[model samples]
Target: MSAAATDHEHALVYPDEPIYSRITAGKLAMWLFLLSDGFSFSGLLLSYGILRGSSQVWGCTTEAIAKTFGCIEEPALGINFTALLTFLLICSSVTMVLSHASMVEGDRKGALKWLGLTVAGGALFLVGQCWEYWGLFGLFGPHHGLIHEGLKFGATHYATTFYCVTGFHGLHVLTGVLYLSAVWIGTAMGKTDANTLEVAGLFWHFVDLVWILVFTFIYLIPN
Candidate 1:
């Protein structure tokens, strides 16, 4: 590169070089924010761990156990149902990558198509989450939802921690959905570049990953 091409962002910085690193300022800022957010999740999970470990009867797995703990008969988590939600998130990550690839390839319509699907996936996942919590009129199957099945929040350490961790992650998904929707609108208007979608992908993937961990610890772990 010639000195004529040099344009320093700061007097102390090398000409024609990034001030901080290879990533653009937007991406770097997002990474830093996610790091702090990660710490918050870690704290919540740690508290849950401490409580679960110290309690002799964290969750009532059987009638005899519930009787011993004097807990109302709470339904065991429907692992099959929650597993489907996890799969939905993982698939959305794939669509997000496709959308980025399509944008870079100059396929405007293709990018919008995949990106639209990605948004739909996120929306569907949120609906599924609501169904898990409240049953949503009991439309799908016999299950009437967790809360109605006796997993009310604040009733026990098990119930409270379950809602806190999963509910927090649910909020992230909701935010991701809205963020993607705005990006979709901007993309349609030619106001956004591939980098914008990539940043959105980072947040979406982060939420998906956190959900995986939350699933393992909160649902997969045995009482």
Candidate 2:
């Protein structure tokens, strides 16, 4: 090539490229990954809404259903066990963010500490959910609830949809706990670095975000 042509090419290429530039390829990839995860969550919530909406007994009287459970408990559709679950998930999200910050500051100890706390929170939430399951199913014997009462009242379908919808969400929480625990282990073992933490944090936040919607639609909204 001619010297003049080579000189023109070099002039077109500036030499002062920023070493630590903003929005690198990796960060852009993370955003796209997060978007896919959001779609997954949206599908779950939308499917739930569609399934529950088509049910005839879902919007029936909660108070009337409560009578079958042999208790004076009112069906106040406020925050219940579901709200507690939401709180735990939110707490986990906060810990995950703290872990990310710790790693960014190059404090491996602090990062591990926060990761341990996050795992503990996840474990505690799982235990609470287990207890909740026993409470609902009456592990020692037959389950008693407005559900059984509903059956007697010819509202069997009502009980079915109620358990199925919330039970599916509980399963999601269970799976999320396991996923977070795995990430915690990797972070502790030094296998995951700041980038890994960032990716994990994105998933953790997505879980919490999904719970917010679940809590609102399933627990907060009155049927």
Candidate 3:
């Protein structure tokens, strides 16, 4: 047989088209997982809304609330600081898109660089959350942390919902960081491909988008 014919015969075969709705199995699976995950967040946020809306006061900012609840007064959510974290996630989302674009363009180095930035952004956001919850290393600025000041989980509806929602989202950020790190390493070793990176990007993008909502409902909303 000719060399071309022999090589063609041995070439691996792939599905001629996507498994469903012009989407690959991997992408479809990720979408389904995201949908279920979305419901969890929705339930949490819905409960938060109902509680906050029905309550006479959301935060223990006033003296009467502090006295009535028998709980130490907790400050309102800090929009300024959380806003910074939001911006970081937004920037990370951009880097994630660039990473996927680079991979699609067959530029492995560019992909790696952008993906690294995306991971860093996620890592930093987690650290920021830590700083928000508890001062870093319990060193300087410890009192500013929510835990140190107040806002303890199970303390109040405001505090509980804040922790449950933001904490849940923070866990997602942490997961995304680790997930992207694995993909980053795999890509560096030449095992991962654009499709793989795209799936990771979908997850990272979902995380960032969810944070926007969390920040809005949990922080920006007037208490």
Clashes of 3: 0
Q: Which of the two, 1 or 2, has more lDDT?
A: 1
**Which residue pairs of candidate 2 clash?**
68-149
Please name the candidate that would achieve the greatest TM-score relative to the true structure: 1
Ranking by TM-score: 1, 3, 2
User: How big is the positional error of residue 91 in model 2, measured in Å on the Cα after superposition?
Assistant: 1.4
Please give each candidate's TM-score.
0.90, 0.65, 0.88
What ranges in model 2 sit over 4 Å off?
1-34, 51-56, 59-78, 136-172
lDDT on C-alpha atoms for all candidate structures: 0.89, 0.65, 0.89
Judged by TM-score relative to the true structure, which candidate is superior, 1 or 3? 1
TM-score result, candidate 1:
0.90
Summarize candidate 2's per-residue lDDT along 1-223 as a digit string, tens digits: 9999998985553334477355445556867876886776677667667767785445445566546554333333335665787788788888889999999999888888887777777677766655544445675345344433332222444344445545655665566667667877887788777777777677667667766876787667766
lDDT score, candidate 3, position 34:
98
The predicted structure with the larger TM-score, 2 or 3, is 3
lDDT of 1 at 207: 94
